[model samples]
Target: MYPLNLPPAQILQLSSQLLCSGLALLLVGLAAAYGLEKQLNVPTLVLAHSLTLIGPSVLKIGYVLRLVAQQRLKDETCAHAIA
Candidate 1:
C-alpha cells in the first residue's frame, strides 16, 4: 500500500481552531462596522464591511497561488532529475 502522507487529526483540530478564530474576527469586524455606521454614516460602514469580506478572500488566494507555484517548481525539479 502506498503510504498516504496526509496531515494528522491534530492538524485538522488546529485548522478548526483557525477557522473559529477567523469567524470571530469577521463578527468583530461586522460589529465595528455597525458601530461606525451609527457614529459616522452608511457609506463608511459599507466600505468597512466590504473590506472585511474581501480581505480574507484576497489573502487566501495569495496563499493558494504560492502553494501552486511551489508544487510546480517541485514537479519540474523531479522531471529534470528523472531525465
Candidate 2:
C-alpha cells in the first residue's frame, strides 16, 4: 500500500522473485514444523510453527496476486505506449 512508485515491470519482476522465495521458505518451514511436531511433540512449538508457516503463506499469495496485477498493468502500459 505504500507507494514506492516503481514501474510495473520492476514490480512484476521483483514480486515474482519474492513470491518464489517466499514459497520456497514456506516449504522449508513446513518441513521443519512437521519434524518438530512429530519428533518433539511440543504444543508451544506447534503453535509457533503454525503461525510462521501461515503468515508467509498469506504473504506469498499476496505477492503472487501483486505480480499478476503488475503484469497486467505493464501490458496495459505497453498497449497505450504503442497506440
Candidate 3:
C-alpha cells in the first residue's frame, strides 16, 4: 500500500525532485524537438514526443505532492495547537 503518512520533509524533498526532473525533461524534450525537427528521424521524434508528454504529467504530480505536503504541515500545526 502507498504510504500516506510520509514526513513533510520527505514529501517536500520528493516534490522538489520531481519538479526539477520534470522541468529538465520538458526543456530537453522541447530542445530536441526544435533542434532536430529537420531530421525527422523515428527515434528522435519518439523521444521528443514521449518526453513532452511525460514531463508535464510529472510536473503536475509534483505540484500535487507539494500541495499535499503543505496540507500535512498545516494539519500538524493545528494538531499541536489543539493539544
Q: What is each predicted model's overall lDDT from 0 to 1?
A: 0.58, 0.68, 0.89
Please name the candidate that would achieve the greatest lDDT relative to the true structure: 3
Q: Write the per-residue lDDT of candidate 3 for residues 1-83, one digit (tens) a residue.
A: 23467898899999999999999999889888888777879887899978988999999999999988888889889999999
Query: Candidate 1, TM-score vs. the true structure?
Result: 0.54
* Per-residue C-alpha lDDT of model 1 across residues 5-83, encoded as one tens digit per residue: 3333433444455555556656766776876667857777777687578656644544444454455557668999999
TM-score of 2: 0.53
Clashes per candidate (backbone, < 3 Å):
0, 0, 0
Better model by lDDT, 1 or 3?
A: 3
What's the candidate order when arranged by decreasing lDDT?
3, 2, 1
Ranking by TM-score: 3, 1, 2
Most accurate candidate by TM-score? 3
* Reference-based TM-score, model 3: 0.90
Clashing residue pairs in candidate 3 are none
Runs of candidate 1 with Cα error greater than 4 angstroms are 1-39
Consecutive 10-residue window with the lowest summed lDDT within model 1:
1-10
Residue-wise lDDT of candidate 2 within 1-83, one digit each (tens)? 53446666776667776677776666766766765666655775666476567658766765866866676797788999999
